[model samples]
Target: MRDSEMTTCAPTLLELQWAVRRDVLGLADGAASEYVVPDGLAPQARLAIYRNTANSTLLTALRLTYPAVQALVGSEFFEGATRRFIGQCPPLSAHLDSYGGSFPDFLAQMPEAASLAYLTDTARLEWVVNQVLHAPDGKPLDLRRLEQLADADIETVRFLPSPAARVLESCFPVDVIWHAVLSRDDSALAGINLDADPVWLYVHRGTSGVAVDRITEEQCRFTAALLAGRPLHDALVDGPDAGTSVWLAHLLASGCFVDVCLSSQASRRATGRQVA
Candidate 1:
């Protein structure tokens, strides 16, 4: 049979499941309703339960990920906007914490945002924070090994960022906005200059918790390039902005890197105690 013929034919159980998901997310009309046999109550009523649960779970997930966005916008407005977002973007990851990564893009294009020009950037910052909070505890870089290496290896050396590291660049003063919103400091928030120039941030998790720190553009460039798997030499001289040893020192002190390698193969730091 042809492609059209397959759709016209009766769907299997798996196809019905996909159709139900599409309908639940409001991506399709209620065509799946015809397939669901009414059990005690109408099929639509049963499906409504699933919709409510899914929507509620998604709302909670977004609330956790985008707390600043919720605090910036009132609860009523946030819930309304998130509901629309949920309909458009169904959860792809099994983990709720992994959802809502695209919420910043959604906020950027929202027509209702009149005076709140910074909401989108604020959301982007929040998403980075959320990622750092959930990132795995990967092997940290061996600084002793790095320091012991000869000057030649250090030049061509590659470093991998800790799984928890994230860099964000935004036109708005989103770090200040995030701090004000999360801390509930009305004075700090009121004093913000929304039209400030672009800001670069380095986000990471530590013993103290997730830290979002403002950084220079040069630091941002170097850190971002290393995160992109570029060698240290390339990242240092890759752009108009040049990185210094001070920047490298600062990042290393912040525990930004997790692994180092002289060439392509990674050189992991040994951690386990000697076993019997």
Candidate 2:
């Protein structure tokens, strides 16, 4: 064949076979060819061992991310759930940490988990905890700068929640459910009820470690507004029962708010006013 004809030819059968073998091995399914198998082992058996190892490694990662969910569902049920979850939502990111982001939603729709309505939310909280642990740290807002703002400026300033923070709301009492699963002792079980109304929760990293706190619906809404870049006045317009001063104090005390920004117009006004 001429050089041009040879260059245009398709891959050989051996090349195709090798490609399949590499793919299968990378996915932990072992080589499809018997060439690599041990003398005593069947090709299928050797391949099965690879499949088992791959699944087990994946399952271990999944378990680490969704420990609370695993605890709630028990090991056997969680194993089955993880297998189903993997089949439906294979890892898309190179980082294993990015995997299992959809696991909570998957559990919510699962018939086997229907009875455990809080299971999905618990999983979600666990996921948030993982995110907080891994999120990049940034310097918090300078309280000194905050003190310089006039009362009116405070109304126009937007506050940013910490990078390591996440808010979760669920119809099931997910905070209580998380506590039940994570707490070493269950002594405070008197008023704890799973069927109670939904609750809002905040999970964030602190000086010690990742921590979860139960928060009010109003706090959730206010924080969400701030995070969404709404001005302070606009955020407080629909905030829970308190005057702006009182609400601002409460927010500052929460330790969730970390940064601030003034609207462009407000910043210009402040500069002009100061210059005048």
lDDT of 1 by residue, 68-136 (tens): 999988999999999999988889866988999999899888888657988998998889898999998
Local distance difference test, each candidate: 0.84, 0.73
Off by over 4 Å in 2: 1-54, 147-156, 184-191, 243-247, 250-255, 264-276
Q: Count steric clashes of candidate 1.
A: 0
- In every candidate, how many clashes are there? 0, 0
Pairs in steric clash, model 2: none
Question: Could you tell me the C-alpha RMSD of candidate 1 in Å?
Answer: 6.7
TM-score of 1: 0.85
* True lDDT of residue 87, candidate 1: 84
lDDT of 2 by residue, 163-183 (tens): 787788888777776677677
lDDT (Cα) of model 1: 0.84
Q: Could you estimate the TM-score for every candidate?
A: 0.85, 0.73
Q: Which is the leading candidate under TM-score?
A: 1
Off by over 4 Å in 1: 1-13, 34-37, 147-152, 238-243, 266-276
